[model samples]
Target: MNSDQEHYIQWQKKEEERWEALCGRCGACCGAFDKDPCVHLSRDELKKYYCTIYENCFGIKKTVNGNDIVCGSIRTILHSHWPGDDCCGYKKALKEKN
Candidate 1:
């Protein structure tokens, strides 16, 4: 690729990393506070939440209570409300940007 294209690709990578870093891992979006979290949601020793199948989490999935859910990009649902979403770093960042 051309030098300019390569530089753009690198910049895009950094932006994606920055966007991913904004997630506080609170698991609220995964239904943690609703008491029916995603089947793959997991917590670490530090109490941080993660997805066991994050690499393939998008698409149809089931909650712990056997409820069907469709997983997609967080940006798609940012305007929607969830129980503990006030603690979401992504939402906070977006709010600050506006």
Candidate 2:
């Protein structure tokens, strides 16, 4: 692969790790509070929340209860309101410094 491709791979890996770290596994944004959650939502034995299809999670997806909704990068929802969002590390970091 070219240097550019290698750089992009490294960047993407870093970005994904950053995104993973930002979540507290609180599950509110996944529809936990609405009595329905995305079908892709899964939990380990410890009950930590995660997306089953995380790599392809962006786009229109259905809730476990079958409600259709759009999914996008967290950046898109940064300004929106949702449950458990208060636990978002990225949002907390922004709020604390401003």
The residue-by-residue lDDT of candidate 2 on 11-54, one tens digit each, is 99998898778778777777876777888888889988888888
Tens-digit per-residue lDDT, 40-92, candidate 1: 99999999999999998999899999998778999999999998999999999
The lDDT for every candidate, in the order shown, is 0.94, 0.81
lDDT of 2: 0.81
Mark the regions of model 1 whose C-alpha exceeds 4 Å error after superposition.
none
Best-performing candidate as measured by lDDT = 1
- lDDT score, residue 8, model 2? 100
All models, RMSD in angstroms: 0.9, 2.8
TM-score of 1: 0.94
